[model samples]
Target: MLEFRDVDTFYGELHVLKAVNYKIEQGEIVCLLGGNACGKSTTMKTVLGVVQPKRGAVVLEGEDISRLSTAERVRRGIAPVPEARRLFPRMTVYENLMMGAYTRKDKAAIAEDLERVYELFPRVKERLAQSAGTLSGGEQQMVAMGRALMARPRLLCMDEPSMGLSPAYVEQVFEIIQEINRQGTTIFVVEQNANMALSIAHRGYVLQTGEVMLHGTASELLGNEWLQKVYLGQAEATPAPR
Candidate 1:
């Protein structure tokens, strides 16, 4: 549903994404995995139109949206749960959710989507009137996901959704991500947690120093000796199906 073709991005003279090419098929969950400074987050920003590619295109469906505004991208069905879940700290949970639908005019549909978000995140429902800043890390992440869903996106882009949470919370968040995919929204997530991310991904790509080093089915990557040694920290251990 989304494609990045020969994308080369930079921050002034500092080259970041290097000829990056990948595709996120419709109704599938794809993940980009790497450690810090691997250009994973930059790929997400490129998709959201926050960082334009100096070369190549960002295609949604069949059209090139590389030059489109962020709001236009959102309207075209790209909703992102950005790194750090940048919520409106002072706004109540409900109000923050409302802001997600700012691009829409259909009140009835917006209300329905709100209820749908509440259904997916009961904790968010419970904290409807609470300030977003007061919520726990896990709760705030839920609020972020719920808010993104409010936009009714066809493709959801999440950057490090498992960051800064307890192990239990991380598991819960990955499970929620799977559920979201099962509900038919395509997902493209960039993560450092390879084990957790690949456990739920339909396919995975390994990025290193702004380039794709490997790409394959999730199970194939999970079983790769190099992948295990470098990312999973299981050198000399046999690969087992997750």
Candidate 2:
């Protein structure tokens, strides 16, 4: 559903994404794995048009959306579950979810989508009147996912969906991600937890120092000696070629 072609991005003169290339097919869950400052989040921002590429293009469903505004991208069915779940602190949970539908005017469909989100996250429904900032980290994450689903996105872009949470919550969140993908919304996840990300991803890409170092199916990545030694912590494994 989305493809990045030799994309290069920068903040002033400091290059962040260097000729990064990858693709997310419709109905597939693709995860991008990397350590700190390796340009994982920048890839997400590039997809959402928060940062434009200096070279190459960001194509969505065959269209060159390299220059499209963020709003336009959202209208075209791109929704983000931003890192840290950036919800409106003072807004009620219900109101926060409604913001996801800001670009749409189909009242009935929006209501039905709201119900769908509630079904997916009963905790959110229970806390509809509660302020978003008052929820626990896991609850907040659930709200974030529900908010993205509120948009009825065709392709959901999730950035660090497991950034901060207990181990149990992390497993729960990844399970929910798989469920979402099973329900037909393609997912592109940027995560540091390579094991968890690849465990649920159909395919995975490893990004190191702003470049894709490896791209393969999930099982192939799991069996890669280099990836195991570095990301998966199999210290005894021999290094494989980049």
Candidate 3:
């Protein structure tokens, strides 16, 4: 449902994403894996229109959305669960979720979506009146996911969903991600945790120094010696051809 066609992005003179290309098909979970500063997050920003490509296009469905505003992208069915779960600290959990529906006017539908979110995250529903900042890391992440769902996104872009949390929470989150995909929303995840990301992802891409070095099905990536040695911490594995 989304495609990055030969995209290049820059931060002034420092090039970040170099000729990056990938496609996330509808109803698929595609994961992008890379080390620090390798343009994984930049890919998410480009999709959200927070970072425009200097070359090529960011296509959603069949249209080029390279020049669209972030809000316009949201209206066109993109919702983000940001890297740090950047929630409004002072806002109540319910209020934070409502912000995701800011671009909509249909109250009935919004209410129904809210109920769906509550069903997915009963903890969030229970803490509807609590300040978002007071929640634990796992709780905050759940709130973040719920908020994005409030937008009824066709493609959910998650940046570092496993960044901070205990192992149990990490497993829970990935399970929820799989459940979310099973329920029919396409997902494009940018993550550093290669094992967990690839475990649940249908397909995966590896980026190195701003370029795609490997692209394959999740199991193929898992069996790749080079990927295992580099990202999965299997130092004894031999390198494999890209």
Q: Which pairs clash in model 1? A: none
Cα-based TM-score, every candidate: 0.96, 0.96, 0.96
Off by more than 4 A, model 2: 236-242
RMSD of each: 3.9, 3.7, 3.8
Q: Measured by C-alpha RMSD in angstroms, how accurate is candidate 1? A: 3.9
User: 72-175, model 3: which lDDT tens digit per residue?
Assistant: 99999999999999999899999999999989898999999999998888889999999999999999999999999989999999999998889998999999
For candidate 2, write residues 1-242 as lDDT tens digits: 89999999999998999998998999999999999999999999999999999999999999999999999999999999999999999999999999999899999999999988988888889999999999999999999999999889999999999998999999999999999999999999999999999999999999999999999999999999989889997687657989
User: Which parts of model 1 have CA positions greater than 4 angstroms off?
Assistant: 236-242
Give residue 169's error in model 3 in angstroms: 0.7
- What ranges in model 3 sit over 4 Å off? 236-242
lDDT of 2 at 226: 89
Question: In order, what lDDT does every prediction score?
Answer: 0.94, 0.95, 0.95
